[model samples]
Target: MCTIELCTIVLVMSDAPRLRHQVCFALYSASKAATAVYRPVLEDLGLTYPQYLVMLVLWEQEPRSVRDLGAELGLDSGTLSPLLKRLEAMGLVERRRSAEDERRVDVVLTDAGTALSARAQAVPQRLADAAGLSPDEIGQLHATLGKLTAALNSSL
Candidate 1:
């Protein structure tokens, strides 16, 4: 007869929950690595990763309400406000109160911001090259992450 000690089983099971095995940690680490890769590339364009994301959203559709931007970006007023302010200071975007609603603020891209879209167009391919991932692999990764995000959000 073979017998495994109860203490040995408990110790082994505990190791399963270690940081190396955590999905959250893996995602967190990967996000940090991706941002690090974007740092220098974005620096040349005078934008941070978060700012770039905001610009990307605006590039897709401009003159968005602060509330709309917040929801799309998954950011609250506190974080989005400062980012908008900074972009405004850089002459990249402008914020104004809606004529119909004094409480609503709309964010619109400046001419410079629109022109910057041309320069920023190369960022995606550059980032993919930096990560050494082909387009197919990047697409797969993006799809998998989308599913993961949906699963996690649904759970919450």
Candidate 2:
């Protein structure tokens, strides 16, 4: 009886880590894994995930200023500078100083960048398939994640 009781105690303790105790850490890991999966797919187009995000914004709206992109992407100037430089180097984007305000920098897509849109049109569908989720599931997930992001963003 003593040995059986000891074994039961050990088994119970062993199951502790399996509980949803570290929700934040689990979410962080999930986010990184999702990005990893996107990496190879984005690389096939000669772009990084961050670069792809920048393109997504420009594809939706053209001839935006750097500050405008930064605000939309929630990136600071320091972080965006290098990413913009890389995109510019890849001939996918162009950065030029605004004539009206020398301090303002505009970010515009090049012909190559604009052309890349046709190739990218299928990415949303592909990602949806990869997620192994239905359209309704994706919508629900997006709504939940959006709320989570908004809450975190406001606190920050």
Find the candidate with the highest lDDT and give its number. 1
> Taking the tens digit of each residue's C-alpha lDDT, what string does model 2 give over 12-130?
99887763678788788777977877877787888888889899999999889999999999899999999999999989999998989999889999999999999888777767778
Model 1: residues with Cα > 4 Å off, grouped in runs: 1-16
Considering summed lDDT, which 10 consecutive residues are worst modelled in model 1?
A: 1-10
**Per-residue alpha-carbon lDDT of candidate 1 for residues 1-156, written as tens digits (9 for 90 to 100):** 134677788778876768887899999999998899888889988999989999999999988999999999999999999999999999999999998899999999999999999999888887788788888999999999999999999999
Q: For model 2, what is the C-alpha lDDT against the true structure?
A: 0.89
